[model samples]
Target: MEFHHLGVATADASGLAALFAELFDAPVAHEEEFDGMTVLFLELEPGYFELLEPHEGGAISRYLENHGPGIHHVALQTDDIEGALETARGAGVELIDDEPRPGAWGHEVAFLHPKSTGGVLVEFVSH
Candidate 1:
């Protein structure tokens, strides 16, 4: 597996994007909406940075409120998403999705609950 991206939950997407752009010289590569989340992709050296803002009342928004804005999840690039999910399950990790689904950047991904990952949400995405 390889490092894919870091997901940051923010209440203000444009503002955060601007901050990152100015601070790190990152540029917005793309933007999309998926699974009730508004996402913006910012290009970086190693991989990408993703800013996720809830489009409606949901878990991401709740996370923002309770956690107070920071790294929400870490994404790993995988050759097989199903295999990764199975591995996580065998290791007793709780999965947020029962099956791999469409994700940002034209990949299929699944999420493992933070409770299973030392309080860090982990996402596995098919490369």
Candidate 2:
């Protein structure tokens, strides 16, 4: 697995995207609306910063309500998502999504429960 992207939950993706573009020289690589949120991927050196802004009352909205705007999850790239999920399961990690689902950038994604991942949400993404 390799570092893929850092997911950030915010109420203002455009604002943060501008700030990050100037601060980190990370221009927007992709932008789309997916799963009730505006998803923007800012290109970094080797990875991306995925900014998520919810347009409806869903997980991201709930996250903002409870935790405010901040880092949401860390994604790791994998060639075999099923194998990675199996590894996580074998390690006793709780799975939030037992099966991989469609995610931003049209990748397959599954998340491990934060409670089982040292309180930090971890995502496995296959592009």
Best by TM-score: 2
Candidate 1 clashing pairs, residues 3+ apart or interchain: none
For model 1, the run of ten residues with the poorest summed lDDT: 29-38
- Model 2 off-target regions past 4 Å? none
1-127, model 1: which lDDT tens digit per residue? Answer: 8998999999888899999999999999889887788799888987788999887878888988898888988999988888888888899999998799988768888999988899988898885
Task: Please report, as a residue range, the 10-residue window in candidate 2 with the lowest summed lDDT.
Answer: 97-106
For 5-105, candidate 2 gives per-residue lDDT tens digits of 99999999999999999999999999999999999999998999999999999998999999999999999999998999999999999999998999988
TM-score of each: 0.90, 0.98
How many residue pairs in model 2 have overlapping backbones? 0
Which residue runs of candidate 1 sit more than 4 Å off their true CA positions?
A: none
The lDDT per prediction is: 0.88, 0.96
lDDT of 1 at 8: 93
